[model samples]
Target chain A: MRIEAGRASRRYWQDLWTYRELLGFLAWRDLSVRYKQTALGVAWAVIRPAFTMLVFIAFRKLAALPPSGVPDAILVLSAVLPWQLFSTAFSEVSGCLVGNANLISKVYFPRFLVPLAAMATSVIDFMVTLAMLALVMAWFGYAPTDKVVMLPLFVVLAACLALGAGVFFAALNVQFRDFRYVVPFVVQAGLFVSPVAFTLGDVPEAWRWLVALNPVTGIIEGFRWCLLGANAPFYPLATLTSVAITLAMFALGVWYFRRTERGFADVI
Target chain B: MSDIVIRAENLGKKYRISHETAQPYRTFRETLAKGFQRRRGSAHQEEEFWALRGVDFEIRRGDVVGVIGRNGAGKSTLLKILSRITEPTTGYVDLNGRVASLLEVGTGFHPELTGRENVYLNGSILGMRREEVRRKFDEIVSFAEVERFIDMPVKRYSSGMYMRLAFSVAAHLEPEILIVDEVLAVGDSAFQKKCLGRMEEVSAGGRTVLFVSHNLGTLLSICDKGILLDAGGCVANGNIRSVVKAYQQKAGSGEDLAPNLIGGPLKSVTFRQVWINGEKLGGSQFSPGEPIQIRVVGNAAEHLPEAVFTLSLYAEGGRLFTVEDRPMTLHQGEFSLQVEIPAGLLRPGDYSLALGARTAAELATPHDWCWGTDLASFELNEVWSANCKRDLHGMINVNARFTRENAPILERAAT
Candidate 1:
């Protein structure tokens, strides 16, 4: 082991690879801890998105919102699935550093693994919710179009967005701690702002660009398009914008996390 | 020649001590105010405390090096830097082997996880692979003496059991260089002895070890070399015996025995001087069963009724014995109190004195005036008398008298 000041980013990627087992263990620990004492166990993961889908279904009907020619429940679940992944991943990643302060202060590992592993837990939750969505579709006798094969690409996009934002917020939370309060607000506001309860087409055409700025908008609409068929339009321009923005966020988060990681043990 | 397993060059760690707010997490209002102050070029003053500064050392392979220092002496900081837990603010350290640090036992053990699961979790956290943990799993369980409870959640285990399990995992770690920080102080004495034995075994296998502990006797026994740190810098580095002796002499010197006055609501009384037998005392040696006198001189800022002064005596084994509270009314200015302890009571060991005072009205806050633990320490030595035996068992001398049951009084002999 060679330790030098201001050389954190030098071999960080290789170190992360070496510490990959830590990432797996951390993710496993988080998932186990989450469902350990709960009466429902892993059912809690599916219950959250299921309840969210039901609430959105009720809201869509009360608002008399126009549907995208698909079953309302399917439409809501598809959109809500990615949003659940994003929100959970964001919240877990943001709090990862402070939550594992003991490990950070006492042991040496690539700090990025903390937020990355926390994001992995949310990904696990997303997969469980996806399976639930599949069951709901089977009940509705809705066979997804051949486009469903393209869904993994969109899942990766959502994961990247969550990890990027989570890494950034994790670093900020260590210093300001005001970000802890800010994160919940962002996740809550994101529920309405992103195209979670409704399709991006339902958004007025003039303000659609503003919604596209939110990467999750592209992810939710993309999920719907893949699972519900082309009835959910795949706007190439909007998807490209979302992809570009998500990658930028990921890069910025990594840069900021590495910059602040050296100071975590000291300040934290 | 043995290879140099570790080398630290000019390592330093600096921390900003914020005085503006006591809270570690700043509020939004404070952050905003700080931003405004920064823009105006008038920021809050923060003192920088160098936990370690310009420390340099080299450890050869198979050397068991002990790190000795007083609290806040930067020993932990140096270990942290070497362990890569924190980056040094300056300089660097190079190690040529796999390094595992046990800064504390059970560092990442989850209370809710079972022993079987936690062993894996802790093993991985210590940088062990899955296969390594699996291979050594049985040994760890047996070493901890928790084979029957291995499947049970650690939260249900007693504290001793938990500590044993944690230490067992760390002991099984096969790092070429081990860094341990006072973790052997956990569990029972038998477990501590087992841990020390395990560490010696590790060192005997030609692996380098850096151990930090306040237990001077243990360090002297186990360490081949010692590094003494004082005020964030290395003061002495040499053979274990001399290093330990230097630390003890420096620690026992009378210069640092001055009482530290902590300001509070009841700051009316402050310690002016503390003396043993009319001499400043810092780890002074006294003969067993000899008459020892402690004189405490203090100043009262104002007239006070119901002022009670107490001197608490503490043995090295953490037993506390307090002198009777001397209640006295004091006018403004200086007052002195003398306490005498007849010698034959204490055994040959280290003892410390803590001074405290409280008013009847302020009984709730006993430390309001002059509370300092281990502020001045002295050692008791065994002195042989013509009739008294030199080697005695346990801490106090009773001077027992013997009598025969069916015979004469045996000349009324005392044993």
Candidate 2:
């Protein structure tokens, strides 16, 4: 490999692929260490979506909102799982770089793998909740239509959206510690702002497009529609907007991350 | 030629030091505040400092090269550039094969993970593939001597066991060109010897190695070539002996020598000066069996209770001995202390001294003391020693009396 002035090697991507096993190791380390001594262990993953489902149900009842034709339990859960995935992954990725300061400063690998691997723990947690969602659907006797095949695509979309913003903030957090404060606030506010607990239709007709500007909105809405079928019809224009914004953010995040990648070790 | 495995052309790394900010990273509010302050006509105090500049070198496929320098001489920057941990600001380095750097051991070892899990984790972090770690799993465990506790979390292991485990994984890394920092400074003497032996085997196997260490003896023994860096520039590069000689000369004389106050003073006690035999040491060389007198002068900012001064001697790869002076009370003023090492106490070898001062309250934390390692060094020349003909096996100098099996007790006692 040739290391040039102000640039990495010509085979940077190849270098990343050569170190692919590191991703698995790092991911495994995080997952195993996360719940090592905790009483609940992997059960912690199920608790969040279940708790969020209960809270949303109580919220809908208190507000006396009109429910879509689908059962409230499945509607809130299907959306909550994806939202949980995005938020948890987003926060994890943003903090991964700072958390592994010793590794970044001492060793050389594709630095992005640290944040990318961070997504795995959240993905595992999402899978746990996905299994819980299946159990809930079985309890409510609500199976999906053929549209369920599209579920993986929306999951990918949610992952891309999380990774994009997470990578961007991860780089930003290295330079300006203020981003640490910014990330949790955005993730928390994102739940109410996006259509996780409430459908995009709940917003006024004119503001639906604005609500869809949040990349997670389109992903959550699309995910819910896949699970609930005709009962949870999503606005096509909003989904397109969400997809566009997610892709754009992914591009912007990667561009910014690469641009600032070299300085990470020095500053961090 | 294809035999040349690593080459660098005019490599340099520059860092922008901002006097306005004391920390490496800046808060967003501080950045905004700086912008506003700049608009108010205050000048910015940013200076460009080159950590490594115009360093050019090449290494053949099997050369074992040592990088030697004092503090802030940019040895680390050069290694970091070669290791690809950081990019240089000017020029480039072309590495012919896979390069792995052990800047520190256990780079990514999680304390919460078991020893078995950490080996895999650390192995992959050091750039080994999973299959490679799996293949060497038993070897690493046996080398670390933690086979029985492999499933136990590392936090529960003794400090020696932890360091051994960490270094074992690193020792097994088989990159074509390996770059290592001073990771051997930890662990016991036996373990350090084992590590050095493994390194020698690596060099013998025809893989290129670049090592950085403060132990000159280890460097002279392991490396045939050396690069000496001074003030961010390569001053000497060639045969190991000559480069080390140049480094010694640079560190020994002129304005850089004597009474070296490294990194300024610490806490309330400011080390003002140091002297050897009533003269500034300046890295002087002394004959073996010669008494070395060292004097330390310092001033306390306030009344200090039970302040202890210590001087430690290090040789070969370990600290041989440490002597602590009596705890004395100082009433906020300058004071001088003298330590005399009588003749016949030191062998014919090179040794470094570490000076430390701490109060009783800070005794528990070793890092909290005002200390410096290799602060001022002296060499005991064998050629000039009276006991040069005697064969010595240990680090210290001690005389032995041998008696015949039938020797009379009265004759032995009279002698």
Candidate 3:
């Protein structure tokens, strides 16, 4: 009889590929569960950001915040689309490890999939939000720009930034349940810190250097650049900072997640 | 040898058992103070409590090994390490094949999902491919007896149905190594039997199984080898029967649970004051005519003394019952009381027991710590009456008295 194969070193990448089906299954399961027994159904996915955009419109027109070069509605909608996607993705993934503690504790799989699949569910919402974005842009009579081609690139950066930052929080969330309370504050703090409704030009020259350091400044500007077609867009330094920050966060996130993942099952 | 499917050397796991400060830095002051007092130890002095220490073992392919242990033993830690749920603090383990674990059924069950969907969900969790799951779906439903309700959301099913569905999926996944931990206790007797049968089938089909359970009978039936883990370590390993025999010997005779089981203040404080005032009294054993006074003196931390103090005679197979108050009334605290086990009621049998505690509240397990795992058991052996046989042990009674005076003679003469 042939003996069983011995354990191999460095089978992680292949194993990840092989387990793609599980990731698909987990994401699908989450979507199904999220929509199940809901009154408004999937409309909430569209309505959640749509409602947030309304809030931004109020902040602009009623609250006397100036339009950031584009129509108040269009600018707010675009920023909200990305912000909601990132927040939803990050929040879902932050709790993903804890939510799957049972599965994590019982069996072995590429743990990257847990967080990845968590982020995957938000992709559904992201796509839905994209539909809303295109509909709004069409209604607003804004022509498509060449910068639009780079939209997907900035989108990837946004996801990488979220996925990366979310990993550390998720790991810490398990050990310190206080993170649950802290998470909402961080999300809110980030909103004020990012250039969601305002343009980078709105910042005084004195603080532009500081604002440039914020990873989201690059991302939001990248998004605006893509949408507005370089009317005053596409700074190389900002893009570099965005890409660098995204990479740094992704690298740190993966490492921190892997390091803390070893204890997740027990601590969770 | 099947290339030694599992191997471990010097594996150790340390857990910080704490119910205090969340982070390593205890306080803001501590963090700042430590930097100034650099000569002092760091701000975070985490206590290292090791759960598993230098645990080493090897299992060949197709070996069904039972891991036996008392509560707080390292059984779960070992399983967690082998399952790759957590990492060891030191050393390493190597596995030659894919391993699956059923730490509990429905590990990620979404109650809203249909049974059919959950089957796929649970199978995916065990790392089974969809095609593999689809192939086994029919068998799984049939085994779980949930075929008719497979399309319905699991939340609607009885808990029994949920457990069966969950277990069936795990069973059909067919991983190379399966680790089971106390999941058999979920379903009822028939389902447990079915699960045991399925476990046998899997091992027979050549997959290695590692099982942890408190039920000795179940372990003895399924496993060919046994490993007994004690407090944070393995005390015995090897043949199942021999190890089980050694365990039984270690257990000794299950008797004499006085202080450990019963929690209440005895006649201690204020007895001198009350004894002189004729208010307090204490005694161990009392005759039927004697007034037995027992004053329970104890204080409960959070819970009030709300359980009924049951004074009863138990003989033969069950508890012969009596109670002074409803269980809800007795909370936790220092309390003492008077109890009377009515004279001549106890038919002699070994019944050594003192009052423990049980609440109507739902406890996780019978052996769950709050329930008090092994309570007091006392022995009772005394002759009550000639006609009263030992066979009648349910409720006890001494002697029913009947007297015939001179007036009865006239009535007897007429008959």
Give model 1 RMSD, 1 decimal.
Answer: 6.0
Relative to the real complex, the DockQ score for model 2 comes to 0.79
* TM-score of every model versus the real structure: 0.81, 0.87, 0.73
lDDT of 1 by residue, B284-344 (tens): 5777767779888778988887788878776532434776565677889989888998868
Between which residue pairs do clashes occur in model 1?
B289-B343, B289-B344, B290-B343
- Please give, for residues A98-212, the per-residue lDDT of candidate 2 as tens digits: 9999998998889888988999999999988999999999999988999999999999998998999999999999999999999999988999997866888778888987888
The order by descending lDDT is 2, 1, 3
**Cα lDDT, model 3, residue A176:** 66
Q: What 10-residue stretch in candidate 2 chain A is worst by lDDT?
A: A4-13
For candidate 2, write residues B1-415 as lDDT tens digits.
5899989999999998978777899899888888998999897778899999999998999999999998789999998988888899999999999898999988888999999999999999998888899999999989989999999999999999999999999999998999999998778888999999999999999999999997776787799999999899999999997887677667655443333444324577766666776655435667665798988777788887778888988775568889998878877988888998888777777677777877774567543357766666666767644545333456676677886777555545554
* Best-first order by DockQ: 2, 1, 3
Off by over 4 Å in 3: A1-9, A63-70, A203-207, A230-232, B1-3, B19-39, B42-46, B253-415
Q: What does fnat come to for each candidate?
A: 0.68, 0.89, 0.44
User: Which ten-residue region of model 1 chain A has the weakest summed lDDT?
Assistant: A1-10
lDDT-superior candidate, 2 or 3: 2
**Preferred candidate (lDDT higher): 1 or 2:** 2
Q: Assess each prediction's global lDDT (C-alpha) against the native.
A: 0.84, 0.85, 0.69
Candidate 1, overall lDDT?
Answer: 0.84
